[model samples]
Target chain A: MNHFMTSIFLILTLQFTGVSSSLALADDSIFVIAGKNSSLPQITATDLKLIYLGQKSSLAGKPILIGQNESIQESFYATFTDKDMTAINQLWGIVIFTGKTDPPKNLKSDSEVIKFVNDDENAIGYVSKQPEGDSARVLAIQKSTTTTSK
Target chain B: MDLWKNIVFSCRLFIFCLSLATALATSVASELQINGFGTVGAAASDDQSGYAYDIRNKINYYHDTKFGLNFSSRLGQKWSWASQLLVKRWVDDTFDDNKVKLDWALVSYHPWSDLSFRVGKQKLPLWLFSDYAEVGFLYPWVRPIQEVYGITPLNTITGASLNYIKQLGTVNFELNAVAGDSKVVEDRNGGIVLLANVKRAQLLTFSLIHENFLLKANLGKSDAVDVTQRTGSSSYVFPQLKYTFASLGAKVDYQTHFVWTEIVTTHVEHLSNMNGLYLSYGKKFGIFSPHITYARYWSHNYKSVRADTTTSTATTTVRVLSYVPERKNKQQSLILGLVTKITDRSNFKLEWQYIDADGYSRDTTERSTTTGGVTTTVTSHGNTKERGFFDAHPRGEVNLFSATINFIF
Candidate 1:
């Protein structure tokens, strides 16, 4: 019964406390990039999350999402999507087991992500730094006001 | 043979999936993707009471540990196939009858980007986390609550499912319907406790999601049979029974916080009625996620009836209806757990559970016979005790500890 009471107190305390995303993002601005020839509109954070999570097939056009398997993913996800690399992989595990969708195409580094996006007109990905010249088009992100990076 | 027909059905489905996988063979391995998940765990309890059948002072690692491999392939532009092969290591004869099994074997046709149809053996979409309930790495706990998930053994359904999804901005709406037939038996400590057979089962579910919040509602019905009370000299079988259930589930995931809850009510014609619910809250701090869950389950049987034809005359018929109270497994439990992320693909979990039982029955009423043209009605009052899950109601309480490591490849 002591445990029960302690648990109840904790539940009540947590229930009343409203928690928001605390991951700061001012230091780095990860760009949502695609091929220069692509015609994609500015996307919302939700749509970007959906596409990268393999839950959505496309946005305006048939776009193939490319994932990054490097350290940049840690900050890219934390800044844009409130989740970390571990949480992202956990979500993919369940989605794969349920036969919902296949894993996204993952590139090894920022250069690989950039090269792939520049090669395929329908390929979209995220990179730590902006692409050089006119090689790729940056998908302007419309972040929700409440979830905007601090 | 009818009692074991479900086993045969599962075997047939397994072979069907294998044959289809072989037929869709391709030299290029990348086209057919492969993914696998595994969990190794052990549990023990300090209680020496025989009531705690499997978890009494002994570290048990066989039942909770399991591994499975999933295969998925895109046949054409609109067709796809998926199959899962589950393997378990059993150190005893309890599960020797079922060493290896297939978890899912289905072919899907996406007529539209938002609509799809699948037919094969698939897991029942019963709860909030039913899809990934078995994969411990997906959840923060060592196991799902027994009060809600342990009511029956009917997890797999061999039939067809249709899903319709509509994405409106960030919010998504989905309506799913499934129809099938299945059979299974409950085995506890190598003893057959009861059996469930579904002749015709149907489920309709609707869900809505926005951001990290999800709400789901479900309704299901089955024309089935109930076989119980086999521990004594005799067993009772309620055939041609109608079982029905309705459930509501909700979950909120924002940042590192998660809250999940679900309520369900079920009824079996001429048998019993049951209600169960659970609420869980968890939060992640860095690589560790600590969580707590509270759950409860209760049941009550329908009033019984008896016919006294021996004393009936030709002019009138005598019928007696008795409202007897039957006690079943009424239980409440609290679970405290912590999940530590070892790496991106592995997790180590620990949990402490406290279970308190509250329902038991022992009849001591004596009824008068019709020896001298006398008729008596049954009584509801009985000698009551506290027992649930635990066979012996030692103190009507138990404390269990568990640890596990889950990984995906």
Candidate 2:
């Protein structure tokens, strides 16, 4: 009976490790989609930050919209900028105080961003995962991973 | 009844215009945005025996309060506008001298990706950070070295400027040209004087930056149309370099440190040549920062002409003394400062400085020798080689303490 219990414990531990590893890999793989009809070159993390902060005057020498979906963009912001929602508000406060720039236009959905970008050639935005419509294309992918040690 | 209808119509029109402006700014103008910054604080110096001396002689003394606001915005494509307002006291006994003043108002334009143009009143781009030097939030010090930067004019220009910036791999080059009229009127205790002159300025800089290393060379020249100005036409050149080493998860939170040194040579066409050297070292933590700076200024013939008047009815013949209006002055100072970030939008800083000056005195005459029962008289003139009853002046020392709060919204 003691031997039987030991074998059962080993089986459960192996299964749990496999499941957790796959979950970590899945967490790292992220999908990025453009708004409606933006033909911007693939974006890097730096480019995304610049566009959202309204620092990039134009994309490829052409002006682009600095619009984003509040909820979705908020996630990307927390992960990358260390500037969560509170930090974002403070950043805007500085911008307003300096009288240098204004807060970006916030949209509610991926579709709205798509429509806006599609309507203007200079517009650029992002959506979670790959987009389904032909009006836009995938920009890039962001990956994070977890490591476990015995 | 008619007036009521007109008022309602005006109100509606105003609301509609406001909405339309907001909509267009958000949808159409990708490059335009308006932002502002402000700071309101009280400053008091415990060193009542001495004065609070900034790089520019003395900015304040005793207990005083100062407040300032700045507004800047980018236009649709290439244009931008900026303005600043400040109120502070320059009084020795009290804060009654507080007055509001316009610090800057300028319009800037970018003609090309590598070239920018600016017109109207603009800040002189003499140093690397001159463009945003006044704003305290961006810097770790309560104030930059005032003596080195204070002598330079703060603002003047009713003309235009052209700037070119280009990048070749890791190296960036910048060139600027300014032309037009530079006139300033300082209103102090109801006394006013107008400073006018035809002005011209040029700035050339070459910068090479790589990750944690930065190197730069700056050369500047300014020519005044006339010699009536205190800071006559002068040429200034300096070179500086800095190395920064910091990364994530180091034993030290900031692990980054930088050391920078610069030497500036100032040559006024017909006057004296003032040479200055500045050295600084700084370190940063995740939130805390500390820096130390040292500067030395020396002039051969420190002839800062305070008054040049011609008396019509002179009793004696007009004669020029061999050493007239000649005096040499030297300044040495050390500053220790700290910066603390309270929140994302709020920051505060405290700093202390020690300044010493030597070789500043007027010439006086005394007895040189007495022989054969006859006393001989000797004349001691300013900057003269003759030593007649010479007296050494004690070194002037001053300690300064100041604090400031900065916020943006």
lDDT of 2 by residue, B1-409 (tens): 5466446545544554464457446744453333334444434333333332212233342122344455555565566676665545432222233445565676777655566677776565455445555556655556645445543443445667776655444333445665555543322211212233435654554544322344555565555533232223321221111111111110111235655565655555444556666677778664566888897767654333333233222332222222224656677888888866655556677788776656544543333344454545555554433111111222246566677776653
- The regions of model 1 sitting more than 4 angstroms off are A1-45, A58-72, A106-150, B1-28, B49-53, B89-98, B226-235, B303-325, B362-386, B391-394
Report the number of clashing residue pairs per model.
0, 13
**Candidates, DockQ:** 0.22, 0.10
The whole-model lDDT of each prediction reads 0.70, 0.50
RMSD of each: 9.4, 13.7
Pick the DockQ winner: 1
| Residue lDDT tens for model 1, A1-150 | 999999897875543331233544346567788878877666777787777654566567443445553645666666656666667777778677887654555566668777867766656787767778887788854332222222
* Candidate 1, B1-409: lDDT as tens digits: 5346447535644764475456446423355667778888888866754323455667766446777777887676577888887765332224334345688898888776677898998888887778777788887778777777755556778899998877877778889898998766555542435666787899999989765888999999997754453444545456688999888999888888999899988888877788888999999887678999999988877654312223455444345433334556588889999998776778899999888878766443334334345555554466667455564664647888999999986
For candidate 1, the TM-score is 0.75
Residue B125 in candidate 2 has what lDDT? Answer: 48
